[model samples]
Structure formats: structure tokens, C-alpha cells
Target chain A: MSLTKHPSVGEFLAGCEEHVNPYRPARLALCPMAADAEISDVSTSDTAREGDFVILWGSYTQIFGIVLKHGEIANNRFGNFHHDEIIGRHFGSRVRSRRGGLWLALLRPSPEFITQSLTHRTQIVYHADISLLRALLDARPGHIICEAGTGSGSVSASLSRALRPNGKLYTFEFHEERQKQAMADFSTYGVLDVVVSQHRDVCNHGFGEELKGQVHGVFLDLPAPWAAVPHVTKCLVFGGKVVAFSPCVEQVDKTATELRRSGYFDVRMLETLATNWGVKRQDATKKKRRTEGTTGTTAAQEAEEEEPKDVPKTSGTGEQWLSYQMPMRSHTGYLLVATRAPDGD
Target chain B: MKAKPTLGSHVVLRDLEGAQKVFLLSSGANRQELRMGKYSAIPLETLLSCPYGAILRREADGGWQRVRHSIEVAEETVEVQENNQHLAQDNSAQSLSPSEVRDLKQKCSGSEVVEALASNSATFASKTKFAQEKYLKKKAQKHVQQVTLLRPSVMELCETYYKQSRNKVCGLRYDYLSSLLCQADVRSGARFLVLDCAAGLVAGAMAQQLAGLGEIYRLFRGSYPEKGLLELDLSESEKSCVRAIHLEALESSDPWSSEWLRLPEAPGDAEGEAIAPGRAEARLTRITKRHNDFKSLEAKAVDGLIVVAEDADLCAEVLELGLPRLSFGGRVCVFGHHLQPLAALQGAWRAGNFVDVRLTQLFTREFQALPLRTHPFMVADANLCEGFILCGSKVGEAEPQEAAGEDSPTKKQRRS
Candidate 1:
């Protein structure tokens, strides 16, 4: 039942937007450590090149930039490094500025990194809200999804990944320029083929008839989602899901009231708080050494020597891990989810 | 997943009291109608192909009309509620007596009865729009014959059964279950060692998510409860994938024992497998399945380890005894009622091996998301016992490094 097809580069360019890459590499490679952290840098024809996005890291600070062979330089507080130096290099390989001893680590992109670094054309949805949103929608790898008001495609990007290769996201945005920019961002993010951006207002005219009776999930983020309730039902498949995100309680009340009238049931609303955590390895070397018949000076000096200090050893006092809530966004819009009737009464 | 309410499909019928009853859709049970309650019944043909969530209305005649798909909501807005100078304090607002209203209800549907009562109300026109809307909505909820058909899910099943008897399921929260599934990272094409004690709610959820690609080793302390999973609605194949293991057998060095892998006996008219040869062969079959599961489990480790046992000591036992059952980088999450058990379990894993041993308590607040009236739903369930979860992962375990100069304590007596 799963149409799990990972779109190839050619098919990816067929019907969706494609971003410009200075060098077109075959695949994406990620480096976990420094540009050169003694890890073997195996050269491959699939390494990153022009057009592919690469992250530059130095002194714990990282920046994402598109690769270019025009000798374009990426400048940050660390210094400036030419794009040519990064082109065709292994993702984990290090690069240096022409003059200063400034060093930068080149790496590939990931979901966690993209959520933080994506350039926003509008306010983007947080990753936590997106996860809970997908859960409410019963999102699987090959679900046919529809998204309205594609703000910055932050949620859309996550949806694109969730849809996988064979699935599709029919995302609509009323703003033409923002729609175009989101389309470009999807391509640069390597998931353009999985999403189809339409420059149209869904509430007034509806998501086209072709998608009617086939969509597995629908998500609305517009000011007037209630107006699109009829249209959402038209496009949603039987037993499918519809999620509407709104900040105000009135909007949820109206939307829920409308859904209550139709064949939608199991209506539930939730406000997802995405709590980030900071993990630090506790000092886990050893406990205090005990000895009898030792004098005060002897015990004091022995205790000083008994204190274990090893940096590379594993962590935790007796365990190896610790975590606390990180200072991050905790509140997002409330999500209202309902299911289409499995059978028409 | 086009879950049409065809013949013999499982469907849940919801009552006005927010209770749900599930049964098979059999038209033959009632020749002319689908018998719901003693008096309230709809024609069989009318419900034959009705959507699970559609609202069917009986006309003045013995016919029905459907308000299908989305509910036709009139775009009505209500301003703030004004002073109630024109309204009565209670039922005094209506002139009709209780017995008279009941008789009218027997003849007409709830909505029509509401309309009749509204027109007859002494102060119907005096109330503001907001007050009128709220009053009408509450009345409809109380009297409406409107029945919403719901597709059965883990949450609905638990909520329905929880209301009937919370003690049956041990107060497993819906939000907590969802969070556990996500944090445990359950997926298809993998094996999981789950210790579920939530009256099959957690097990049913994981089984549905696996979608027949993976295996669930459902460990229980005593004998497994077969009826607990009656409402799970898992397919035969999915059920077969879930191996019921007695917690005592998990301590055995051998996983091929009958307590660990209890494969059903082969078809036979006689007792004891009909023949010793057939019994021997079934044992072989059982052995192969165990080998397959354990080979991959020991190779890549299990995808995740989940425990929802109420016994607080079970977390420590599973971690100490079942750590090898999990693969590297896999999550081990234990769910319980209090933080005391988790505190002890956290201390048990203090060998610097497990990572991110977090003791978490989730507050699943239900808010009435109504503008100008948005507030948390005040209910008795909100005061239910709060549960705790301890989530950690199996990674690199390092021996505690000792001080460089601190030698092992030594004392000796010198000979004269």
C-alpha cells in the first residue's frame, strides 16, 4: 500500500521547482565532526559541489551556504573562504582562508540543522509542533497531503520529508513571491520533487477537483479556515484527517463547530509544546577513595591525589548522561484534528 | 485504508452520555431496521452505506435524509452576552411540563422538539445572541437524537473503557501513550520488547503502528489476558507477530522454551498435537522463529524497548536483565505511576552505560479552545493519578576510572 519512491534528480526536476547549484553532486554527504577531525575523508564522485547547500563550522558557530565555483567567498566572523576551496571537497574536509589562519569545517545538512538555519519568508512552524501535527494527521511515509498557507515552508519542509519520495504535498500560498521562494527552498533542501507549490487561495476556489476524494491529510493555517471546510472535505479521502492550526480560540470554535456538523468525528484539539533539552555529560571518573590509619595531612594529600580527572572518559556520576530543558520556543498554535467518516450515512 | 462501513465491519456507536459501544454491522439481526436502542431505530437500508460520521435524520414519514460530508455550519457570529433581565432563572423559562416534553420527544426528533420548546419559551427573545446560542447548544447536546459514528482507535477505546472502570486499564493517559510511542521510536520492520500493562491499549497502538512488518514480544508478569485484546481489532497475522512471554521466562537463559515462544499447536482432532511427530515438528518451527528473532535482535539489537508495567521494580529488572535484548543506540523507556520507582531505576542504571536517563511527567491538559472563553476543562479525570516515564538509551558503557594514586585499601601486621 506504500508508494514509497525516492524521487531521482531527473524526475525531481520534471514538475517541481529546482534551485541553482554551482556544482551538481550526485548525493548529499554529512560530516559529524570538524572539517578535519582525523576521520578518514574518502573521496567520491557523489561529494557536494555547486548548487548543493553546505554548512561551515568554526569555534562551535556554523553557517549554511550554497556552493559556487565562481570563486565566491563565504565570509563570517571566523574569516572568509572561497567557494572553489569547498567545491568537490569531501563534506568533512577542512578549508582555510587565503590569508588569516581562519579554519572552517564543511558539512552537509540535516533536519535538526535545517529547522534552525532555514531562511524564512514568513514565520515558520517549529519542529515540535510539526511532529505533533503529523501525529494528529496519521501521517505515514506515502500519504497524499494538502497544506494551505505555506508559511516559509518550515512545516512544509518537514511534511516534504514525511511524504518521502513517492508521496506528494499540494501546498498552496496566496502570496506569489513567497510561494516562489518556498519552492526554491524546497529544491535547495533536496525535497522539491516531493512537494508541489500552487500559487492560489484555497478557501475561495478550493484545492483543485483532481485531488478531491484522494487526499489522505489536509492542514490549514489560514485566518479563515472555516471558510475552507467544505473544500477540505471535498479533497479529503474517506477516513482521512484534517488539521487546522489557529492562534485564537474563536477560530478553533468556529472550525470545530463546522466539523461537528459534517461526517467528521473524533475531533480533538491540542497545543503542542516543543521542549528542547540540553545534554551534558557529568563528571564520571570515580568516587572518593577510602583508607584507614592515614594522618590528616596524609589523608588530605591522598584525597587530592585520589580525585580522578580524565577528560575523554565516558560521563555521568554513576550513569553516563544528563539533560535539562533548553531555552527555546514552547508555545505554538493550537491544532484541531478531525477524521472524515469511513462510511457515508 | 478506505474504511467503508460495509457489512460485518466493526463500528462504534456513541450515546449522548459520551459513552461508546462497538459491534459488528449485521443487517440480518434486524429485518427492517438497524436496532440501536429499545425504541430508537433506523431502517436497515438507510444505514447500509452511511459514512461512519454522517448524521441521518428521520423525516415525518418513515424515510431518512442525510447531511453528509462536512456539517453545514451557518456562518453565525455572536457578540458578548448582555444582562439577563429578560430570562428566567431555570426551567421556569419554559412553559411546557417535563411529561409533556417527553411525549413530544417520542413523536418528533430531538432537534424538532428543541425548536418547539424554543418557540414556546417565555423569554426566548429577551436573551442576547450569545446567551441564546449557548443555551441552544447545551439543549441540543442534552436532547438531540444526533448519533455520531466513530472509527475505533486506541484513544477512543481507552477513554470509553476508562470511563466504565478506570481501574481496569490502570489510568494510562492518551497523551502519555502517544508521547511514549514517539519517544520510543516504534516503527515497522523492527522488533520490540514491550512490557504493556495498560489493558492492551499500549500494545494495540504499537501493533497497529508496526503494520505487520515487525514483531512485538509482549511480556507479562503472569498469564496473558486474551480478552484484553478483544477490542484491539488486530489482524490474525498481526496477532501472531506478538509473542506472549511470561516475565519469569525472560530470566531463563534459553528463549526457545514453551513459556517464551508459545506457538499454537497444529491442526488435530485428537489431544496433544495428534502425534508426537507433529509436536516435534511444531517445536522445530517454534525454534526457527525464535532463531530468526534473536539473530537479528542480537545482531542489530531491538529497535526499541518499552515498559508500561505498574510494578515499580520491573524497570530495574528489565534494565539489568534485559539490557542485552536491546541493540545499540536503541531507546529504553519505562512507564510507571510514581517518581519513586523511576528514582530507584535511575540509580540502577548508574553504571555509566545508559544515556539521558530522564524521569518525565507529562500534563495532558484539555482546554476549551473557545475565544473569550478559552480555559482548561474542569473534570474529575484531570485529578486522576499522574504517571511518570523514565527514558534512556543503551550506548557505550565505560568502567568507572579510579584515582591514579589511590591504591586498594591494605593493612598488614608485621612479624616480630
Candidate 2:
């Protein structure tokens, strides 16, 4: 029987073999060309309409488009396809475009999930800041981490991805609403198992009740962080790492004072603000040919009468295109890194 | 074009009596007391929000000390003159220090000339040194030998000496120390007794070289580990050979070990006291009597302050204190076997902007060496004028904020 006879039947066959032997499919794979044949024909259109099968690529995979009926081919910019097209595909597979030339694939997110996720509340670190923080903190998998003010759970998500299965994140959020949002997001991402979001203020209670001496890393995004110094000590182990994000120098001043009082060795604070500029050519004299009598009269009708004169150099393919260099999402609070006293250990 | 106030821009305060103005404070006006130089309780918040750069100086010392808007002084007694015309003439104009200008442009671009004058070469040099001295003295007094009622570690205490000397070269050794004292992860109220192992002493000639760095901490250490040690090495070459050699020798040696080299016992004291400890205190008296006794002591840092006997087996009871009194940042800096006992203290404690300051020393021309020890301190001095050092940590944490100055997004956009 031809594999093309039915759609989900292929997935059922594949899943059944995997359950029985797990290793037999790789040995018995027959035609590699057949798998690519179906995908090669799949294509998409530019404009999205309701009840169409559209592909959204980031983080996870789902056969997304408006769902109409059980078996009807959903109309989409891409050619009509049924749910059967996706039944056998894995979450991170790619399907070919209708054009037969272009290809679209699913994205398999790195365990560091901080870079792509929606924040529920409190400002999450921008992608730029997250990249920098990852480098600064030397973030690695399986490392124990503690975070304060777990806004939207973006950072926690990223950190959790970097953690080994045994690794866990102890996060605190003062606001109950933010905590719920973060909790919900964690659950949705299937990372709730690794993250424990608590609703308590570090400034009031300290890290004692939750993290007492267990944390390997600590990150705080708080206002008036100096007040929490007494509490941080209770939770942080010797040679532990700590980073604080503050906007103002006044807070840095007070916080630094507290760190010295606490005895964290190798403390250093600095700010990173980078600017990107467009490097487009600046030919001031490069102007478009002025079209006289092109304003109010018969521009469209005139073009029709002119028999659709196709300019060899169209606007889309012109050299006078807009080249822009935009700053990545701007303004993240500054970062301060300090270590727990190294000598104590 | 209107000028904005930039972060770290200096401002001069002048009293007006028929426009015969004399500068009152050469330092930048406090952000909170933008115009309260004249009043006892001027609200600086109000003053910072004022539109005009030139305002009546308040005379009182209490309250905010600055007002954003100046009350109209008696017409005969006060006249406000602004140099906005000069600033407007130089809008986006390239100058000697464009980055510095950009910093001043955020808050009061029109008053930049005024800011420059307040932070002029002569003023910053002197003020930075004064500020460094004050910061170090305060930190030393607070964390050094003074009764903290609690102690953190010997390195925490010894760091003060290194920081003080380093700050003399760098601008705010003690200030950095104070800032590290306040980091977020550090446990509050923890005391420490610092035992700095860096071996070097500040000489008068070196102090002169320190006067050139923008701040005291800058003098001793650069922004990075290697850079700071290099700066110290180069500067010490020209300043004091005696202290420099000792420092070099320690830098090349194993810093945490007690096996480098040893000094001979000092002769008997005038009081006829024995030199053995239970007797080391009386011995120290005699040792301090001869100038050369401490002279051979060679490069000693706060991290190196613990005097170990030649016999590694001899256990000297140093740094005996409770965690509350000795804890700084909730942990103490211990060296050699000391770190072993404090294993339980290992973990994350809030600390901010920590730089490991490494020092190199040359005890003998043929035997240049380097020892290692960590001074868990912070930088506090903001004046980027001349090198200065402020303080070191004993039982305190310091937090450093981002060094890029401005707070407002629009102001940053304008500056760019």
C-alpha cells in the first residue's frame, strides 16, 4: 500500500514502531525521498486570511492556522493542506514552501529560554541585556541559581533552559500578581518543575526562608537593594555569585557600601550601553526623477493606457532603498557583579 | 539650543554681592540641592527641576541645601549671569574632551563652562586628593583597627592599608571599599577582619605620582586585574624602591602560603621583654623601634597582615571573633588554612562590582617576586580627576552602580 493513501496513518505506524523497539526505525528506514516529497510541495502566501494553515516559527511547533472543520483543507496563503500534513512531523521539522524554492523550518530553542518569551509583568531584560548577562554571569547548565523579582519569568526561563535536569531555580517575586503570571508562563513552558516562584519581598524577609545557603548564584532586580543586604547573607553560600541591577548611582553607592560591610570579595560594578548606527551610503544628490503632472490627474489610467510600462529598475529592486540600523530594545537597568567572600571557604 | 545637565559634571557656587562673585564650592552641585547653597533647608529636588542654570546661592546648611528655582534676591545684592551664549556657540562642536562634554550636556549644557571651571585641573587635583584622603580615613577609622564591636576577616582589615596606599595612587580606594560594602548579595551586619597579603607601602614621592591619576583607586589598580597590577608596577618603579621591591617579591611568590621567606627575630626590647608571642605584642614594640625592622618586613598588604612564624607548624591565634562581629558581607576573607574552616560560609552573598586587585613587588634586585591575595573591597570615589583610594572592607559591603552617568533616556538621546 502507498504511504500517500492516508496522512495520520504514517504517524501511527512510526509511533507504534518506536514504542515497540525504539531503535528499529533507524535500521529499517526505506525511502528518504518520500519524506521530502510531501514537504517540498508545501507553500505559503504573503497575506494571511482566516481559516488558513499558517506556520509560526519560534520556540515550539504546532500546526497553526484557523481550525474550520475536521477534514476540510484550510485555505491559506500557502496551498490548501489538511491536518494530515502535520500528523507525522516532529515539532522541530521544516516543510517546503509552495514556491518550491524557499524553505521554512521550526526553531528549537536553546535551554537558555530567557531570550524568547513573553513577560507577564515587571520589565524583563531585553534581548541585548540577556545576552550580556549570560556572558557576565558565566551562565551554564546544571548551575543552581536564585533570582529576585521574577518579572514575567523571562530570565528564569532562560536560566532554566541552561540548567541541567538536576538543577533548579529559586525565584522570588513580591507582587502576587506577577508571581502568578510567572508561574503560569513557567507551567506553559513545562519548566515549572525546575523553577519555584515565591511571592515574598527580598527587602522585607531576606533570602532566608526560601533559599537558605543552597543557592550557587543570585540575581536581584530591585529598588532599594541595600535594605536586603542583611537578608542576602543568610541565603548566599561562601564563594557564591551575586549580581544586582540598579538604575541610579545613588542606589549603587548604598548597595556597594552594604557589600563591603558584608565582605564579598572581588566586587566590581560597571555599565554597558552600546549604540548601533546605520551604515548606508549618504549620496545627498541621489534623488528620484521628478514626475511632472503626476499628482492629481490620471496617473493610474495613464499607466494603464501606457500598456503597463515595466521599468527595468523597479522601486523594490532600486539602489535608493532605506537602510536602517536600529538600536536593540533600549534601556535596561545597569548591572553590578560581586562575589561572596572567597576566603571564607 | 538649551543645554542639559550631564552626569558627573562639576558646578561652581558663587555668592553675589554687587556681582563681585567668588566661587563657594568647586565641586559639582549636589543633584538634590541644585540651588540650595544659600538656605538652611533648600530642597535640591526643587532646585534640580529649575529651568535656569544661574540662581541665587543659599547660605544655610540644613535641608536639601539646593533649590531648583532661585528666589529673586534683592536687586542690589544679587545678579545672575549665565554663560549660555558660549555653550550655544559650541553646540555639537568638537572640543578637547568631547566625551566629558557629552556627560555635562545632559543636565546643563549651557552651564558647561561653569562645570569645567569647577572641575578645572587645579580644583579636581586638589579636591580629588582631599576626597580620597577623607574617604580612606573614614573607612580606615570605621573598619581598620577601630573597635567595630565585630570583625569580618584579617584580609578585610589588611585591605584597608593596601587600599589606603593604593588609593593614594588611585583616587578613591576607600570609596571603592565603601561601595563594595553595600552590594546586594552580601549579608547585612556581617563583620570581618581582613588580612591583606599584598606587601607595599605608600611613600611621599609615590603620592606625588598618585596626584596625576583621576582617582586614588585608579592610581593603585586599573579597571582590570592585569591593568591595575601593571600600573602599580610602573608607578612604583619611579616612586619608592624600598617598598616597591618588597611588593614585587610578594607578587611573584605564592601569596597564600607561609613558605616564601622569613625575617630574623628583632633584638631584645629596652624594657627587657622576651620576643616570644604571648609576647609578640611586646616584640612588635621593639621591632617598630628600629626603622629597618619594618623595612625588611617587605611588601605587606592588608591581605598579608597576618604575621606567620617561620615554622609552618606554629599556630598563631589570629582573627578570633564571632561571625556577627567579624562578618562583612556575611563572609570573611581567610587565607591558608583559614579558608578551610569557613567552608560552611560558601555560597552566594550580595556583592557588586568587585575587581581583584593584584600587586607585584621586588624585594631584591635579583629576586623579584609576586604574592597573591584577594582584597574584597569596592570603589566609592566618583571624582575622575587624580588617582585616589578610599577604604577597604572589614565587616561591610559596598555596592557600585553603573558607571555611565545619566539616568534619563531623553537626555541620553540628546547627548548622542
lDDT per residue as tens, model 1, B1-416: 54546665555666545656665566674533444453267655556556666666554443556655444333335656579665557778788889989998778777788888888888876776555666677777666655556556565676666666756666666656666775575643346888777777777777665544456777777656543465656666446556665566567667556455555455563554556876667676876676565543333335478987666566556655556655433567877775444554554443234443456655445566444555666787464325766665544322123123221210000000
For all candidates, state DockQ relative to the true structure: 0.08, 0.01
lDDT at B295, model 1: 45
Model 1 misses residue B187 by how many Å?
3.1
The local lDDT score (0 to 100) that residue A168 gets in candidate 2 is 71
State, as a TM-score between 0 and 1, how close model 1 is to the true structure.
Answer: 0.66
Per-residue alpha-carbon lDDT of model 1 for A211-241, expressed as tens digits? 9788999999999888999999899987788
Q: What is the DockQ of candidate 2?
A: 0.01
Best by lDDT: 1
Q: Which stretches of candidate 2 lie over 4 Å from their true place?
A: A1-55, A58-87, A90-105, A110-119, A274-323, A328-330, B1-130, B133-416
lDDT of 1 at A231: 96
Report the Cα lDDT for residue A273, model 2: 36
| DockQ of the two-chain complex in candidate 1 | 0.08
